[model samples]
Every structure is written in structure tokens, then in C-alpha cells.
Target: MSSSPTEVSGGGVFQDVHIFSQNVNCNYAHVDYVLENLKDSVDVLFFQEPPWRTIRQTVSIALVESDIVMGAPRYPDWLYMVRPPTDECNPCVIAYVHRCLAHLCPSMQWDIIDHWDIFVLSLFTPKGAVNFLNIYSDNAHTAINLLSQEVNMLPAFIYMGGDFNCHSKVWDPAHTLYPLVAQHLLEFASDVRLEWAHSSNPGLTHTLHNPDLASSVIDLVFMGPLSMLSDLPRLDLNCCGPLDHVPISTLVPISEFEIRISRMVILRKSPEESGFLIDITTGLWALNVEDLFSPDTIEVATSAVAEVFSLAWNAHAKEVVITACSKS
Candidate 1:
């Protein structure tokens, strides 16, 4: 919230850092609630399975008051990076840094399948210069591949976070897959050569939609030489709704950059109130309720409702009003 670095103990050197992750189920109410509570404490917000509406509509509505918005291709079984809107939507994930920290914005690139979206934000300070790498990885195997690629491409200072989706089993710790993942992680840490940068809380960052299943620490925050873990904020498992995963937040120390541009776009009218009113009218007329109850149709209806919220009206609120009107 302060947009200033909090000092952290260092083995070598340290940078300020703050990161949080959530699998927000594209529900406006829930997303709004989380952001309201977390906006002040976190610098960057990462999400998975965000509502599938267009970026212009969803980001504007959800993060309208935030500093920036960015999004990437939807990864099937992994995480996606998105933020409030900036000047416009781009290929890399959307980001919103504090207005004072705009100078940190850097060039970004994405890999095939959009599994990994990386952006380098340069930090200038009296101590030295540092760069933060914002990353969102797929599951375990994909995490190994992505991290390996980054090890070669990344510069010295880096802080990577998102859904890494990897679990540790002490038994076969020497196995190739687990060992390979561990080695790659170690390689990155060694490159930075800071003993205190790594913050691992096993089983604390688990994300699962079903309340019954045990949660695993799949979400992570990995720092390089320039930063040290100052504090591990309480993990929010209760925020996990129908979605099968929880959200995680962390705080680190690094230089702050000045954000040059920030913007928020909103969709106020319902589709009916807008020019494309007939799209909704025709879709409703075509619906047979009896035959339109399949999962596919439900998905379509859900999307349509989201569209209404973006273009025409607040779909969820409208539904409640309509039900009340009918009862009256």
C-alpha cells in the first residue's frame, strides 16, 4: 500500500517484493471481495481460471480502480496472469504497479501454449539496479520446462511467482523428475546466490475447489539474489470457493519503480441497453430451457450472463431483480 520497500535481512543483498495468487472463479462478487481486502497489501496479483469474458470488459469491471490491467492466453490445466488495464491489452500479462514505480516496466515475451508469460520490470535505487521477473507457470512438468528456459534467459535480479504446481515427496526425492525440478530451482537460486531469498511453506499454498480434498502448496514465490523474504502472510484458504484452489500472498523487499501509464475501462450498460441488444433477446427466445440445460448450454448461458454484465447490465444483479419482479 505504501509503495515503499520494507527492509529485509540479507545473506548477500536484498530487494523489496510482494506477491499474491488466487484462482478467482470469474465471479464478480467474490473477485471484488478479494481485491477489496488485498489491494492495499499486494503489489502484483496473479489469478487462474478467471472469468472467460473478454479482457476489455472483465478487467475494466473487476480492476477498474486499479493501476493497470494485463492478461495472457488461457492455459488449459495451469495458471493465467492478468491485471487491471493499462493503455491497452497486450500479449504479455497485464500489470499494475504503483504510479510512483512506473519506471520498472520492461519488455515481455510469452512461450508457446502461453504457459509462461515473463515481464522484466527494472528497479533503480541507491544500493543498485534490480529487475523483477513476473511469471505464471503451468503444472509440474511444464514448470520444469519453463524454469529451465528462464534460467538461461533471465538476468541477475529476479522474483518469480505464480502457480508452480509442484509437490515434494521426501521418499523419491532423488527421482529424476523431482530432482530435476529441484535442481533447476537450485540453479536459479545459486545464480542469485542469496541464501534468504527462497521462502518455501509446504502445504500452505494449496488450491482446490472441493473443500474435502487436502490442499497442497502448489503456488510459490521465488526470489533471486537481490531480494530476501521478509514475511510470509497468512494463506487464505477460505477464499477458495467453488474453485478447487486457494490464494497465497507474500511480502519481500526490493526497489520501487514509477508507473508511467495506468487506465481502467468499464462496461456500464447491459447488452440489451447497448446497440447489440438483440444478441441477448434472440438467445433467450431461442432457449428451450428443457433442451438448453446441457453443460455446454450452461456454459454458454454463463458466458452470456458475463457478457450482459460487461455490455448490457449486471447479469447477476439483473437476475435477482427479475426474480423479485416476478414474485411481486
Candidate 2:
């Protein structure tokens, strides 16, 4: 999974969506480092074997003591999308979308594909809701088998990637033997109209810690036939950072009409913030609380207060465009 990073030309003019995928090996520190460093550059992140632990405890009605709240790590700049475990098994696949793309209305499609190792994320666009899949198949190929079984029911994902943990000549030229698991994996992908995306820096996607063992290419990414990708995926060998698998990323073009690089926001401690505070204070002062006779009246007053806040925000928020370097 370790390869050197090579500088390639940027994506096409309309290719604004950047996707980064990696296997963190369930390490908290590795996951934290990836999100912290790539938050500014990457639009979406697909992680396999992400750390799932108890973040805190909350009051539980079932038990006398507090219940353990187990989950993945959280970052302010990235919206973490993960499906809760149905039983005791922790989910192996998770995704994160940048806060900048909140307008896209990204959501997890648990109803479509509900599995701990497979995650389906849908991003709403003007054209339609496009889905991306993140998966982690163990040596037994449980996730791949499930996908193959549910091929008819699953959505046509535009982008699908993860660590399949299977070696075949299709993805690894060094591996001459084609195993049964590889055949099933390829067949499943073909049924769903997914094609293998070759990496620019081609090499082993998984490495051994010891010098004696040979490395292998198991982690793979497959893109749907209709995906609007701009270039071949890149294997970032330099950024694996204490992980066995290197990071792979690709750029996808957004529709010209939907390409938005700037957004309006009221920065904290700025003049706009001061004005917003003043306007909110004034609006709250004028709020009519006298009509609290019924629940309907209370709802009306709440709506009025919300409208006032929205008006004030729209009035003072400044429009800021994302810099080109930030997308790099």
C-alpha cells in the first residue's frame, strides 16, 4: 500500500468533486490524521476498518448505569456518515463529506444496503441523487458475496471503492493466478456496471511490516460506467502514515450549472457577526410572546422568530469563494 506520490496535472475545468479513499486499519490516530490533513483538499472520504470505540456514555433507560456510546471519530470540517451497528459488530466501512458540500444533501442509504462492511452514500444533485459505495470485504469476501446476492436490489452506484482483500491479475499484474473470490468480485462489479479504475502510481496497495514478506495489491476502486470522472485515480504512497494501505483518490466533474465554489457565511467576531447579533437582539425584543394561549400560537411565534433570524443572516453574511489551492 506504500507508493511515492507523483504530481499529475489537475482535473478538468468542470471536475470539482475530489474523493479520497483509504483503509485506516481501525487506528484512531490514523483516521484522525487523515481527516485533519485532507479536510481542506478532499470533498469526500471513504474509510475502511475505521476505529469504532466509545466516545462517551449517555443515560440509558434499559440499564441503571449509563450506556456506552460507541462510534467513529468526529471532525468539525467533515460530516461523518455511518450506519449504526444492528447487533454487536462494529461497522467496517464509513464515509465523510466535507462541510463545504453540505448543499449536496449527502445521506447514508441504509435501507438500500444494510451491512456493517458495506456503506451506500447518496449525494443529491440537480440532475438526481447519485450514490457512492464504500465497502470492506474480509478474506472470506462476506461483503462481496452480499453485494452479489443483492445485485438486483442495490442501486447503481456512480462510485464504489474499498479494500476487497483479494488478489487477482485484474488489479495486480504481479499476481498471475486468478482466484475464485476475484472472479466473483469481478462478476459482481460487472453486474452493477462498475469498471476498475487503474491508479496513476501503480504498485502494491498493501504492504508487510517485515522485510521478508512480499507485498500485495488488495485494496481496489471501481467506478460506475457513467461516472463523470476526470482522470485516473492516484495512489498517494507518501501519506499512508502508519497504515498498511496507501490512499487513493480521484476527481469527478460537477455539472457546470451545479459548480459552486463560493458560499455566504457570517464569520465569527467580524463586523457581520456584530450586526447579526444586534439584529437578533432587536428581533427577539420585538417577539410577541403574549399570544401563548395555545400550542398553535406558540408554533406561530417560533416560526416568526426563525424568519427574523433568517432575514438577519441573509442581510449581513458575506460571500466567500474557495481558493484554488484549497482544492489541491
The sequence of per-residue lDDT tens digits that candidate 2 reaches over residues 1-328 is 1111112225422234678889998899888888888876788889999899999999999899999878888999989988787777888999988887777787888888788899988766665566678989998999988986676465555677889988888888888666656766776676455688888778888887888987899888887544535567788887789887888887654443222234355666889999999999999999889979996777577667767876897899776653211221
TM-score of 1: 0.50
Instruction: Tell me how candidate 1 scores on lDDT.
Output: 0.44
lDDT of candidate 1 over 1-328, digit per residue (tens): 2233333346433345465656554554555565555444555555544443443433355565644423433322222334433354332233334332334432233321233244444445544455545544455455456655544333444455555555544212222233335444544544433232333333455545477876565555565333443454445565565555556655656643222211111124744345445545655566545556676766566545544433432232222111100111
C-alpha lDDT score of every prediction, in listed order? 0.44, 0.75
Q: What TM-score do all the candidates reach, one by one?
A: 0.50, 0.70
The total of clashing pairs for model 2 equals: 4
Q: How many backbone clashes does every candidate have?
A: 34, 4
